[model samples]
Target: MTEDQVLDEFRAAEALLEGHFILSSGLRSPRYLQCARVLMDPRRAARLTDALAATLPAELKIDAVVSPAMGGVIAGHEMGRSLGVPAMFLERPTGTFELRRGFRLEPGTRVLMMEDVVTTGLSSREAMKAIAAAGGTVVAAAALVDRSNGKAEFDVPFYPLIRLDVPSYAADALPPELAAIPAVKPGSRAIA
Candidate 1:
């Protein structure tokens, strides 16, 4: 499917959304791209993942696919399956995400990090660091939506199935449509 087609699918699956949402990046926007809406449908999810999988070069030699927990788990599994590699997800423990549950990346393992959406690339970076700490070499990063306009900082190549120019506003800068909604701070908080 084309980029436009993928975006159209995202629009069609709007039921997964709720009241004004503060993205993980701490940016305030009137809308949110709830990937679960598209991921819940196996057929559609396969199609979308296939499109993303095609962008990855065969020579990258990815040994496994890793993604941040919550939103990215399913997408990572789907992409890994499409690429015929094992998949794992990193979850937040304390204040940071780590490879838990006996998950370990062998030395010199080539890993590709996958995400459902790219806002500030904070979570992606954390996942990359974890992979590196485990001795895995990050070959690339993939996301379903790229809203950062390439501003995300990552040492590896980053690819998104859809590139969108969605601008975000701060709490005080939110438009009238979003001004009435309650504000929630973004970031992965630690549980004490």
Candidate 2:
């Protein structure tokens, strides 16, 4: 799907939120993409993931798909379905990503790490690091929304359905406009 189309879906689903919100990455933004809401409809989810899967190069073989849990589970599962691969999730059992609950990869297994939204790409990079530590190769990373605005970097190639340049601010350096508004933590992860 085109960026505009994806954005339209977000709007139609009421997933594109506007408020003084704290992201999972600990940054504050006036806008947020609540992908769980967007991906709630199976048909819309399938269509988006299918389009996301189509972006992968034909030569790249994805052995398995792994995603960071809670936020990414459903979206990654749908993407895995489109790619016809096993889908698994990484949990933070000890405050960091891990292949817990018997979910794993064989040595040299090609993995496609996915997420619902990527702000600073921290979660994706953490999951990739864990996957690498467990003997898997993260071939690439994909996400439903990239709120990083094209600035976040990852160890693997990053592919996002929509590249949204949302403005964010650090707590100590909030913009005057954003500072005046009350901040709400709407993301799944809690700030430290």
Candidate 3:
């Protein structure tokens, strides 16, 4: 689908939010995309995941799809379905990502890390560590939206259906207009 179409889907689901908000990265931004809202619709989620799957290297063999918990769960599942592989998520029970709940990746298992959006990409980086610890090799990473504007990076391939340059600011450097509004924490993680 086109970028406009993808944005239309987000807007239709009211997932494209605007206001003073805190992101998982702890950076403040006036715009936020509550991807969970868009993914709530199975059809919409499938559409996006399918698009993401299409971007994968045709020669790449994926043994499983893994994602970090909370945000990446749904997108990972949908991507797994599209790729015909098992999908599992990492949990942060001890303040670090881990492969829990019988989730195991055999040594040399090829993995595709999936996420809803790639902003600062800290979560994806953390997920990679867990994947490596489990002996899984991440061949590539995929996401529905890349709000990092090409700033985020991964050791392997990174793909997204959309690339958006959403503006973000440090806590003390927020724009006066955004600072005037009461900042809301809409993400799953706590502001750090």
Candidate 4:
């Protein structure tokens, strides 16, 4: 899908939120993409993931899809369906990402690390590490939205359905406009 079309889906789903928001990485932003809302509809989720899968290089071979729990679960599952591969997720019940609930990957199994939105690439990196620990090789990474403005980087090939240049700031350094609004955390991860 074209970038505009991709954004249209978000707009249609009302997932493109505006206001003071705290990202999973603890950064503050005036806007946030609530991917959970976008993916809540099964048909929309499938459409998004299918378009995402189509963007992958034809030469890329993926054996499975692994994503961090909570945000990535639905998108990852849909991605797996799009690619015709097994889908699994990593959980952080104890502050560390790990494969649980009988999820396992054979040694050297090619994996596509997936997420709903990537802001700092921290969760994606953590999820990739957990996939490695589980004997999966993360061949590439993909996300529905990348609001990092090209700042976040990954070792593997990275593909995002849309790249947004949304500005984010530290709590103490928030812009005056954003600082004035109450900040609400809408992500799955909590910051201490």
Report RMSD (Å) for each prediction in the order shown. 2.7, 1.1, 0.8, 0.7
**Backbone collisions counted per model:** 0, 0, 0, 0
TM-scores for candidates 1 onward, in order: 0.89, 0.96, 0.98, 0.98
Better of 1 and 2 by TM-score: 2
TM-score of 2: 0.96
Give the per-residue lDDT of model 3 (tens digit) for 35-109.
999999999999989987888887779989999989999999999999999999999998999999999999999
Residue 103, candidate 3: Cα error in Å is 0.9
lDDT of each: 0.83, 0.89, 0.92, 0.94
Pick the lDDT winner: 4
lDDT of 1 by residue, 1-192 (tens): 787798788878762344576777666765567787788988888888889999888889999999999889989999998899999999876667789988889999999999988888988999899889888999999998888866888999998998877768866688887788876533243213
lDDT accuracy of residue 66 in candidate 1:
93
lDDT of 2 by residue, 92-156 (tens): 97899898888879999999999999899888888899889888999999998888878889877
- Give me the displacement of residue 131 in model 2, in angstroms: 0.9
The window of 10 residues in a row where model 2 has the poorest summed lDDT is 154-163
Q: On a 0 to 100 scale, what is the lDDT of residue 87 in model 2?
A: 91
Assess the local accuracy of residue 90 in candidate 1 as a C-alpha lDDT between 0 and 100. Answer: 91
Which candidate, 1 or 4, has the higher lDDT? Answer: 4
List candidate 1 stretches off by more than 4 Å.
15-19, 180-192
Show where candidate 3 strays beyond 4 Å: none
